[model samples]
Target: MIYVDPSGDDSGPGTVERPFATLQRARDAARPGTVVTLRAGTHRLTDTFLLTAAHSGTVYQAHGYGTPYQEKVVISGGREVTGWTPSGDGTHRADAPGPAPRQLYADGLRVERAALSLDGHTLRRTAGGYTVEGTGPQRWDGDVEFVYRGAYPWSEGRCRVASVSGDAHATTLTMADPAFAQATRLYHSVLTWEGPGAGESYGVDSPTSVENSPAFLTEGTFATAGPVIHYRPRGGEPPAGVAAPVLETLLHARGAHDLTFRGITFADATWLRPSTPQGFLHYHGNGYYDGGALETVTFAEGQGQVTVPGDHASMPGNLIFEDTSRTTLEGCRFVRLGAVALEFRGAGAGNTVRDSEITDIAGGGLVIGDGARDHRVENNHIHHIGLDYRGSPAVLVTGARDTVIAHNEVADVPHAGIVVYEGRGTKVLNNLVHDTMRVLADGGGIYVSGPQGDSHANGALIRGNVVRDTITPYNFGLYTDYGAAYVTVEANAVHRADAPVVLTVWPPLEHVTFLGNVWDADPGDPPGGVVLKDNTTVAGDAFDSDPRAVAITRAAGRRPARHRH
Candidate 1:
């Protein structure tokens, strides 16, 4: 056994009376089958703490399990900012001299960045960059950015400002190198869409908002210069504590097995790669391409087909477990993170994440990538994710095999709730997903694309989920798009969506079955090679009182989650 406390000494023996100061010291002193007990306090990490193959069969737990006095444990990757002086304009200034983080927290609440909406401005694409109809931001410290939607409703991209000039009638904004060229290439790549409203498929072309500028600083926002950090107070109240993320990875392990982490909270980590010169070029469902130029553009037989190398790379997770097996995380919390919360990658098998909470992130929640098998994620609460990058889903499963994602509550996201793209024998069952696609479009509450094994053999199953309140412009309740094949969607209840189910016919879905489902809106027609059997449509209040819908809603989302105070 080993013990760790935040107020203890590092030179002491790892005992209950005299504990080790850091987790690293207790981990180094532990054996293979040891239990490392932690006292209740904050353990702020400057770098990632590691556990490799030598630390198999280890358990990290709270100070007292199954007791009344079990307090909270926090493992944070944030650095506290001191010496905050009042700037006398209802603002505060601190001496922070580094790359600015994408997220900030004041007294454990998320703070918004400085922004100005450009909703009514006319922005025309010029040779260098763009020409705005009104006067642009003229007093920036060289890191002003534009968060804009592309021509496709499913895409969102960002770029930096190099210089801004011209008169009050129109200002010419010059974009930064390489990122501007890469974003323009992706925006003009989609040339054809045969399905509904082909001519009216253009979404917003101009930027909706400009971020990270001093000119846009308001009463509830914060901004950063080269060596100074500026924050405007909300309603003239001073904050008790202020912290910003500094490290990227909080935990990274490879080739380990049989580990457990219980009753802990991981918080405040930042990822700065998206703020680089490459920028963020979002595609769909956690796939982003930053590889400068398109590999191939073929207009021969397929007009809008651009060949990526392997369907683009996914965003890296901040806490990664590679080639690990038989791991478990229960009653944990992950908050104020800048990237994906957890990832299982590279020959991983038989892992489980249950009864946890993941919230307040800039990227996706939980990602099980390729080369993973037989994992289970259930009974968790995930909310308010994709706060910066709007294209990421709450839970994304791609190219994994035999995964089960069931009985979780997912809400308050910008994109899809759960997305499965090219996985085999995966089961998504009994989840309660709502208020999704709150910003972007063309995704659904639960979406599936690409093949999932053979139709006659082990295929995919999406069963008994309750999805509701998808109020986006172009979205569906249950969607199967982009050449999806070999799937069964059964007994699900969908309400208040654009449509119940959107089965795409462009790439032409094949061998898909929708059986015994309940919806508020009727799916007009089934596409070719798809089957719809015994589905019922209830209108208005009648849908809420239906027996099948009542049973499914009652059984879903039993566990609610809370943040660590």
Candidate 2:
């Protein structure tokens, strides 16, 4: 077995006795049957590690080792930033090694993107920017961002501050980027205005934006002025608590078989999205129907499902396994990364992500089965994701066949829970999804759409899942939108939702089935050629009830464990 210790020398022989200091040396020393073990400590990664078929092992055997939940092995993508110079304005400045990072951590915890309050103000969209009335507390530092809370379906408005004008009574922010159509203000007022989209410290009841102006500077807020990061501690300590992200991806496995990433931890990576306009899987209504490409008011041209994205969504991830079969990412923790955690795409069949925890990420979590087949996403807990976009799913699976999404526990997310779009024979079963639509609207806990255009989704299975506490008015517990056909919704429990189920497409949906399911509330009128049979309510509890309606007071989301490996 080849070994890697953080304290070892890179020039060593890579043996356990003469261990190597870096994983690259250990990986280079490994053969088809070789095993590489990482000694428990932090391994900082400045670049992505590629695992190809050259690194594949025998069938049902693993080539990499860290001991599942038994080791404290961390593969970090962030560099330590020390040598803080107090700027005397309640903030400290530090020079970093690489390009400036959009995400930073202090005291071993993820720091908040800067923001200020816009409470008790009126906002107006302008030709050049958006202006806030009754000027709140927002102050512009070297540069600041204008972000907003979405009141409409699938909306988030974010732009850099080009100029800040007006007096203390009112402030007009000339945005560097145009607002998204969904982010544009509807009618007059909204629940609140928001920006920079940070967690917790970002308010819930008031208008909030990340402000860097000296007037809004306080402890625990970090922003960039050219190449330096400005910070202020909560209690005014030394700048030792601050850390900045530098790298893009952590572990990237491509076209390898029988590889296992067991019990590894990935932390502190940054993925700053490009300032291009991006949208969700669906356009709600007013779509072009052909699915060729879409153009929004601001995001005009070149938007399609397999089409390359214009921004950081196209960047690499923390743990990426692609085009490999029988590969497993088991019992791992991916935290505080700037991009997606655990993405499996491109023709990797029979891959599995199980017993993992993914949280505190800026993008989507645990994406698998893009054109891949027979993938399993089971028994994982994913939460607190989409730190930037308000409409990203926790677990997104698209363009794959015979993919199984089962037994996952997803909660507290910004948007939807599990979204299965495109391909055929996709099964979503027995997963618990709650507290979704926490930020954006018009989504589903278990949402299914796509094949796009005149094409339709066929032979999809959505069953035995429990979804609750959906916060938005348009988000449902389960939904099939954009001409999904021949899909089956059966034997599930969905409650505490804006609506239990929604099937809409103008002329309505076709070839959809609702059987043996339990809903807290029935879906409104469906379209032609829809079938609803033996579907019950929350009173009957799996027993037969009234002639017109049945009551199901408890969750019907029960199943026997299926081990498909």
Candidate 3:
């Protein structure tokens, strides 16, 4: 066993009496089947911790993972910024010259970005810029961003601000080149019901809000002016600690096998690609379409709406595992991250992430990418995600084979809670999902789409889950969209959604069965090739009173003894 402690020296022997200072030192000294025990403290990382095939059969565990004396062990990817001085204004300033961070944590809580809402104002799109009524300032500090709600109910796009003109009550904010044009050319504003070819053409509406300007700097918000970062404390109280994320990834494993990580907190990592001039022109879930690679396709589903290219790029993760097989991560915490917390890429097999907590992220919580096989994600509590990018889901499984997503509690997301898009033998079982689609629409607490497998032997099963309180404007409790087929949804409970279940027929669903399910609303008659049998409908308030509903809710989500904190 190798030992690592924050207060130890690097030259010391990796023993309990004289532990090594850094994790890299311990990792380098380790052989196969070595257990690297990390002491209970924050281990800050300057660069990503890399693990290759040489690090196979290794276990990186916390000091007291299964003991009563277990304490917190944090792996941080943020650098401390000191010397805060007042800049004569209300905000405090500090010289934190580095890669621009998309997220900031003050006293271990997320501080909001400086923003101004233009919801009730008259803002018109212009040739060079937008002409807005009742503008606040003549000029602003830092790089500004226009946060737009376009693509109807699916996407939330952003564009960089180039320059501001005009004076006093009226302002013309010229958006930066290429990005603004790309955003406008991709994200459509009109719905499919508007006309026969309404959504075919590319268009974007006025921005719902503007972000990262000095004029928007207020209590509990922060902004940046070039290399200097500024923060205004809530109620004028000073922050005890502030973390500015520097590294995009904290851990990256490739071609490693037989690894385990237990009871470690990976925190404060940022992805800066979205903050660049390229901007985040969101498409669906965690994906965004690039304008340079323009390949538009038409989906016959739902009034023949146009779709972006299928090969869209997803938001990158802060912790990535690429082609790493037989890896397990348990009792870990992924928090305060700017992008996807963890991702499984390539054709990795037999990976598991269980008994973990993921929260306070700007993007998706977890993503099992295409080509992966036999992954298990269980008993995790994922909440308060999509904090910056509103279109990102809580958990997404795309094109993985024999993936099992079970016994997880997902909540407090702006978009879908759990999305399964194209996979074989995928089992989504005994999970509790709630309060999804709080901002964006056309998704659900549990959403499934695309073909499950080639035949019934490898078909998907979504069973014994409880989904409740899918917040309105629009959404469903359970949704099957965009050519979902060869799937069985059984023994699930759904309540308090815009609709109990929405099985789209425009794309012509095939061999999808809904059996022994309970909901507050009936979805009416089944379409061709779809079967709805042994399903019951109850009153909306019956979710609290009904014994079956209460039992299902109690049985779902994280198992009682498995929670880490």
Candidate 4:
């Protein structure tokens, strides 16, 4: 057994009396079944911790920690920013370590990224960015930046200033060039957050157009001016000390089987990969592939403990286990990061993430699969996710098979509670999902989209889950949108929502089944075009209400489900 203590030394022999100071040291010294027992305390790392097949453990043997679940062994990516100088306008300035991170925290709460906008004046859209009218842009320090919510809910783009020239009527900001021109096409639209088109959007022809115009000064805003990060508190409270994330990822392991990460709390990372505002998560298919796979983008470590390959690109997540099997994360805590808490790449198989709590992040809690298989995500508590970025779901499982997502509690998010897309033989059972789609307008408590032209979700089962209180126009307790196919809904309970089940497909769905479910809703809740079977509900249609029934009557050869009028 190897020992690790936050207060220990690196040069020591890693004994319990003189434990290793860093996880990397312990990782380097690990062999198969090497129990790396961690001493109780915080472990703030300055670099990415990697483990490979050479350090792999046996299929069922525990290789990592032997600590109790109550032990607070925090793995943090943050360093407190001291010497905050007050300019006295209810704001403070501190030297930021360059290139700069997108999110910050104060006393364990998320601080908004700094944004500048006019009271009523809309920005003029430009190819590079929007132009700030009058004195608004003129007030910014030279190091100011502009970040916009992406056209898609799942994407965001940020750009540093190439130049900011102020005229009497306007200040035009020419954005610095990005590493990949693909990014230019990725975030062309500035999404409207609320109002006329709450979720509607239009391309930004002028860099200054107000698409999703963020009303000025409601939340905390921040920006870096050269070496300084200027911050405005949310409600007149200056931060005791600014907390900036110094690491991009907590742990990165690929094709390393039989590993276990237990009883550890991972926190405070400033995930930035790719470069600029569009991290590794840009549009696939030449920047227009509907936001799922993040495979093509190459990532390299950069200055801010982030990895942005070119001059621009940034994407981050807490943990990445790719091309591996039989891995497990049990009794762990993941908090306060800019991207997904844990991500498993395409080759990710037979991995399990259970008995964990993930919260306070700008991105999703767990983003698993992209054609991966047999991943089990169960018995976890996920909430307050996508706090900064609303496009991410609590759990996004794409094209993963034999995956078991059960007994998890997901809440307080802007998008779907749990999204299963293009997966075959997947099970989403007995989970509790609520308070989601808070910022987004169209989504589901448990959403299933895709099985696009290229893929199909065959033999998928969504059974025994509880969904509630998802407010939005197209939001439902269970939604199968776009082109989801071959899905089954059985024995589920959907309550307190505007709609219980929705089928808003484009070309329509196929081989879908709904059986023995409980939907407690008001009158006319299901919204029509539903074919229920052997089920119960407070209101709405039954068996004949199923859209598949319409499909059966429409054509002889198993026609597609019809749309609701």
- Candidate that would win on TM-score: 3
Where model 2 places Cα greater than 4 Å from the true spot, the runs are 58-69, 87-90, 119-126, 130-139, 163-173, 177-215, 275-316, 451-458, 505-507, 539-565
For model 3, the local distance difference test gives: 0.84
Candidate 4, 306-326: lDDT as tens digits: 112232222345788878788
What TM-score does prediction 2 earn?
0.80
Model 3 quality (TM-score):
0.95
Q: Any runs in candidate 4 off by more than 4 Å, and if so which?
A: 58-70, 116-119, 131-133, 142-162, 175-201, 205-221, 232-241, 273-316, 452-458, 520-531, 539-565
Give the C-alpha miss distance for residue 35 in model 4, angstroms.
1.1
Candidate 2, residue 475: Cα displacement in angstroms equals 1.9
Question: Local distance difference test, per candidate?
Answer: 0.82, 0.66, 0.84, 0.64
User: For model 1, how does the per-residue alpha-carbon lDDT over 1-565 read when each residue is reduced to its tens digit?
Assistant: 8889999888999889999999998888888889999999899886798989998889888877545777789998888777888867888888663467677788888889898887776788765578776665555553678787644577777777778887867788888767676666665545465765343222225677878876677887887765567788799777548888888899887899998898889898888866776777677777777664456444443446443323466788888999999998878898998989888988899998988999998999999999999999999999998998888899999989999999999999998999999989999999999999998998899999989988626788999999999869788989888778899999999999999888654567899999999999878788687999998999899999999899888887736533221
What stretches of model 1 exceed 4 Å from their correct place?
Answer: 133-136, 166-170, 189-205, 292-311, 559-565
Of the two candidates 1 and 2, the one with more favorable TM-score, higher being better, is 1
Predicted candidate 3 versus true structure: per-residue lDDT over 258-362, tens digit per residue? 989998999989988767778888888899876666554455544444546546789988999999999999988999998999999999999999989999999
**lDDT ranking, best first:** 3, 1, 2, 4
Using TM-score as the measure, name the better of candidate 1 and candidate 4: 1
Cα-based lDDT at residue 270, candidate 2: 73
Report the candidate with higher TM-score, 3 versus 4. 3
